[model samples]
Target chain A: MRTLYQFHGGVHPAEHKQESSAHPIVMAPLPTQLIVPLQQHIGQRAKPLVQIGDRVLKGQMIGQADGATSCAVHAPTSGSVSAIEMMPMPHPSSLPDLCISITPDGADEWITRTALDYQNMNPGEVRNRLRDFGLAGLGGAVFPSHVKLNPGKLDKVPTLILNGAECEPWITCDDLLMRERAAEIIAGAKIMQYLLSADAVLIGIEDNKPQAIAAMRAACAATGFEVIAVPTRYPSGGAKQLTKILTGKEPPSGGRSTDIGVQIFNVATAYSVARAVLHGEPMISRIVTVTGNVEQPRNYEVLLGTPVKELVALTGKQRNDTQSYIMGGPMMGFALPTDNVPVIKASNCLIASSPSLFPAPPPALPCIRCTQCAQACPVNLQPQDLYWFSRGREFGKAQEYNLFDCIECGCCDYVCPSHIPLVQYYRFAKSEIWAREREKQQADLARERHEFRLARIEREKKERADKLAAKTQGSKAPAANADIDPKKAAIQAAIERAKLKRSGVTPKNVENLSVETLKEIDEIEARRTQLKQAMEKQSDSPK
Target chain B: MSTALLIMIGLALFLGLVLGYAAIKFKVAESPLVQKIDAILPQTQCGQCGFPGCKPYATAIASGEADINQCPPGGEEGIHKLAELLGVDPKPLNAEHGVPKPKSVAVIDEELCIGCTLCIQACPVDAILGAAKHMHTVIAKECTGCELCIPPCPVDCIQMQVVQEDLTTWKSKYPLHEIRNV
Candidate 1:
């Protein structure tokens, strides 16, 4: 029996998972236009490969991965690239990002793909293929999976845990996926284990997901894999918290799981890897749980660039009282700016938000120094202190208290009796710190460049001075050898040149001129000679 | 009684000698308060604070000869930081010095530039690059957005453009809560 450990404070918010999981997953229809944001993952945004008016087949690479930390973006269906411009993205900030809007040709055709045999291919080759397939963590982080798989420079990976703990309320996409596709998920896990050479693989699912647990257990019965049922709690699915629960090791603050010889992948992510490796298909869609304030709430296999409004329309008619649309689970998800934003890889659930399902939070009251928020904090950080410091804009003090470790899990907000939006304050503080850090970096760069410019100017001045000094020395050397002062030598040379002119050292062509012209020239030379004699006499008379 | 008085005198002299030695051993050579104030001042060196550079302004503030609100580039937040450091009340920015403006960097029109080096001499940070009788251009990265180069340009070719914030530099403010109609 594998032992399960408990993590620090978690709340049991009413699990509203039954309504969404009652039905099997459905395939969402292709929308007329797919608006694919280039930056669907966490790292650098992908660069567009196809231009406007270019024809693209289904699963065609539209945006290529930019750097080591990014993943490729593909067209969800056969389509013509209509516009690749900045459009509204599915971010809480509602800011516009570069997106490729494609008009589907309704053919749903696919490009030729060849899956690599994992057993025959090298690990590096497998990871490269996964990156091209645009695989990312589908557990809401959407971090590129290829970068995570390499575990760069780590000699050994002792344990690989597949996270199936969909602990957030009102999200059952992963649960249904487990129940239906347990064999495929397990196969994906085996591939990951092969890649990492992990000694053991553990699949953790919440106790609330009994069907998923039974299915996963039956599938992994003979595979030497363990499927443990962890107690259902909000945010147990967080990367750190889940690792702590299954492995009894808390990844140190500001560190990664791989640092402790453990690596984790979302179950859905593993499934995608299995597909990409076996079926030669890229990650162009995901299971999105659409529930709340609708006639029939269920999970649907959603395409990457399908808009939220289209997915909501599939469930049922939304109640008129639907207040807003939230993109993920209630615990950690944010309210989407609008329904027009496309669903990217990180989108796991979309709730048709209504008043009863999510009542407006009561007015925030004053902090009474109640330590409840501190108790509920999963990362064991002092929330009240961070709150006060962030509210006062005292970023230094906030950082001193480990503000970045808070993770904005909303647990403090959930437990705060005073109704303080503690998570919001933490987010504000984090963003402020990030902005200030960027400003400091820019300032440092400017300072370096300015100093370099000053140094270059000084060097140029020295070079010019050295050249001028060398030229003067070269000119004076000849005068010094001739036994005359430099200035006197120059004056004597000018006088000799004047005497030559008076002597009429004319060219052959000039001597061939008419006699009248020759007479004029002789008169001019005589005048010049008389003037030179007068200048010399004047100089002799002077004191 | 005489023995007791002699013992007391000897003890007092020994302690005094120890105290004098300790003071000399740990005495600070320079006032760290000046350095702290200097770190807070935006090192624009624009002379908008009526000082030649940020170091002079910091020295004046440390010596209590100048108020902390004199730096316009630092603006209100800067004044607050200065006030906190000096344990003084935060004051509004001194309008006599200058008004706070959006961050800008000097850009020189290369086509219109006559290669005159007046702007180069005027730049406090030496952000402009050019020699006499050569076209001068402003190195945007090095410019502290001081606007000092504008007045000295003979051709009026230098312009200060507000830096546009892209996705990397832009930070979204905290979202306001929407009141439901119900």
Candidate 2:
């Protein structure tokens, strides 16, 4: 038996896996309309290739990937673009995003498909093809996987970890996936290993998921892949924790697993990769565990953009006390604003939340400083300290405690005897810091623009002066063009003449000058001082 | 003992010479006080503070000629920031200047605009793009919601529209969790 490693600060939350893991995955029926958001993962939103009223085929690329950090969006089925407008997204903030609403024609067609022999193609081509296919990390994070696949500037990676440790309670999507599509997961791992040129491939499934382990082990019989059943612990499925458990080394603080010569992918992500690369299918659906408060707590291969209400309808009846739906696991998931919102790429679990099923947490008490929260923090951060700092709005002190490193896994909340929502504090603090950073950037941009404008105004004034001087010289030979302009420069010099003649200006040329000339000189004198100030500003700005 | 005292005096003189030279070498031309005040002020360039722009207002504040609560776009938060930096007690925002409004960008109705280039001159940040006889459009990102161009428009074409909180601009609201550690 290969020696397994241990990660600090883990809790064995009650595994309610039996509710959903008992049944096999089933395909959800297609909806009448699909609202596809153009954003993929974290970077720039994808640009729409098809206009409204354009016909789209199944697996057709509708939204083009924007940059190296983004991925494409494909048509879920044969449809015509009805509208491209802002629609509510299935996110905690309940904000609307630009979405392509397609009315399906029900032909259920496919674009011309060709399998990729990844072995024959270069690894870069394979990764790029996967990006165009819109393959992202399906296990909750929805980050574009192509960026992770490229081991840039690193020696041959040593370990490839497939996280089959679906450790969140009441969520069995990954377990069900490993049980059924174990071969696909193995194939995907082999492909990733080839790309990474990794020395070892390890798939770590939690010990609680016995059937998934057996299925995965049987599939890996001659594949040179090792299947290890790690001790079931909550948040072991977290990439950092899983990476640490599979390999003794931890990725550096404020860094990715790739930094430590290891790259981890969720098992569901691996299955999607295999389907996309080998079968040439785009990401259109994911296995969601519709578990809480339903008659049949089962897993379904839910098509992206299917309403949560429709999927909940397939689960038979729900308890009357079902107040809301919480997307993802109870620990890290947020309460969905409405069942009307369509499921997106990262939604792995949808729990019909009710007070009785998962009883309402009682009113919280004051912290007694028991250190239970600190003990249960998977990242080994001082949760109590973070909580105090965050509550007081002392962001700098919280950052001093390394606030950004927190994954908001809710392990601290789970173990808090005082029932404090530790994760929420961390989340609020993180968002506050991010907002401040954005504000600082905006301030800097505004300053730069204001300075640039000031400089340009000065340059324009100088150009105007030079032009006026040139015109006066040019016109002096024509018809004494010196009448208006040199008259202006002559006035510009008279301002300093004003300071000298403070007590009394003895009128020498005043008798000969016309009334219009005197008025023009007064106006020009005012402008000359303004122009001098503008010139001074040109030298003041640094950039 | 006299020789030791002479050596100490010589050492002190040498160190003082180095210190004096270093001060002259690394001398900063101006205090950063005005720059810090400017950063706290929102660059609205609305001229509600009786100054031409945020930089002018900042310069006045640093010289103690202007009060700290003159900005409306910066709001009470700006007042507090200025107070903290200058070591003075924070005061209520000066409502006489103008009431604070939600962050918004100016939108021009193209049909109503007469291409007069008046609003373009009024804009401090130069966010408005237009030629003398062409339709003017506001660059939404560059706009600071200053409302400076509104009065200058001849045709009443420009309108201040609030920037709604969408996904890109949305913030996770506070007090989301019931369990406050305090």
Candidate topping TM-score: 2
Compose the digit string of candidate 2's lDDT tens values, residues A387-411. Answer: 8999888888999998988988998
Q: For residues A1-543, could you state the per-residue lDDT of candidate 1 as single tens digits?
A: 778888888788999999999999989998878999999998999999999999999899999999999999999999899999998888886778999999999999999978788899989989988999999999989999988888678855889999999999999999999999999999999989988889989998999999999999999988999999999987799888889999899888788899888999999999999889988899999999998888899999988999888888887776899877898889899899789999999999998888888998987777888889888888999999998998898999999999988878899999988888888888888889998786666556554554565678899999999999988987867854777666787799999999999798765678568999989999999999999999999999969
The C-alpha interface RMSD of every prediction is: 5.1, 3.2
lDDT for model 1 = 0.88
- Give the alpha-carbon lDDT of every model: 0.88, 0.87
| TM-score of chain A, predicted model 2, versus the true chain A, to 2 decimals | 0.86
Task: Give lDDT: candidate 2, residue B166.
Answer: 73
**Cα shift from native, residue A255, model 1 (Å):** 1.7
For residue A428, give model 2's deviation from the true position in Å.
2.0
> Which candidate gets the maximum lDDT versus the true structure?
1
Model 2 chain B: lowest-lDDT 10 consecutive positions = B172-181
Deviation from native of the Cα of residue A361 in model 2, angstroms: 1.6
Clashing pairs in 1: B115-B134
Give the interface-residue alpha carbon RMSD of model 2: 3.2
